[model samples]
Target: MTGITISKGATVIMHFSIKLKDGTVADSTKVNNKPAQFQVGDGNLTESFENCLLGLSKGDERTFELGPDEAFGQANPDNIHHLDRTKFTAETPAEEGSIVVFTQPNGAEIPGIVREVVGDSVTVDFNHPLAGQTVTFEVEILNVEGNE
Candidate 1:
């Protein structure tokens, strides 16, 4: 039998690493010693990211570079929000460079990074931390199982 290749509906187990343009390691499954397992066509990964794995067989290794728009996407200006200091409690102080989760009206929790804390206002960025940045993605396919 031929080895399985990654495709829609395939369950893939892989080791992956992401690095910034400056060569800073962002994340790595290999370092954690935990291979990532996910089914293709699931919302767990972005379309662009999934595209990189398509047609790859087990034991295959590949590296690709993604632009801002293709990766986390260009940072949206509207995602930057300023909130009143009064809204934060002592337990949840809005410290600069800290990440805090804000509950939306729909009960969805969204994480935002505190950009600056002024006297009475705190600037929060709702954009993904990697947004607007180019990144290098490296992957090694450990296994690929097609849907029966």
Candidate 2:
């Protein structure tokens, strides 16, 4: 099997780190001790991030800096929603940092991260979590191959 570069339909195993413009590490596979697997153009990654991986081989590492728009896009105020506190349970407290999943019409569960906990209310942020922030990624292309 020939190893393909970052083309559409290619499956890639990658270890990546994302840092904010303020130099804070927002996410990193290195810290989690696990790699991520995704197909190209799968919407799991931004186009800019995918573009950066194009033509890279195994063991190759590249870093990219992207603005908010190029990354997760600006954080939309509409992505924030307040829910009633009664909807929470003792096992799933309505507290900041707790994640809640809502069922969509398609029956897919979308997770919203809790942003605030207040009396009779819980604020949930449906944003990508990295939105509204400039970010840098240190990525290592673990593997790639043709899928179609």
Clash count for each candidate, listed in order shown: 0, 0
Model 1: what TM-score? 0.93
Which candidate's lDDT is highest?
Answer: 1
How much is the lDDT of residue 66 in candidate 2? 92
Error of 1 at 73 (Å): 0.6
- Residue pairs in clash, model 1: none
lDDT, residue 132, candidate 1: 96
| Stretch of 10 with least lDDT, candidate 1 | 85-94
Residue 32 miss distance in model 2 (angstroms): 4.5
Query: Please, what is the TM-score per model?
Result: 0.93, 0.80
lDDT of candidate model 2 versus the reference: 0.86
Candidate 1 per-residue lDDT, tens place, 22-91, comes to 9999999988799999999998988999998999999999999999988999999999999999878876
Residues 1-148, model 2: lDDT tens digits = 2367778878999899999888898999989789999998899987888888878877788898999999889999999999998878886778798888878899998888999988898999998888888899989888887767
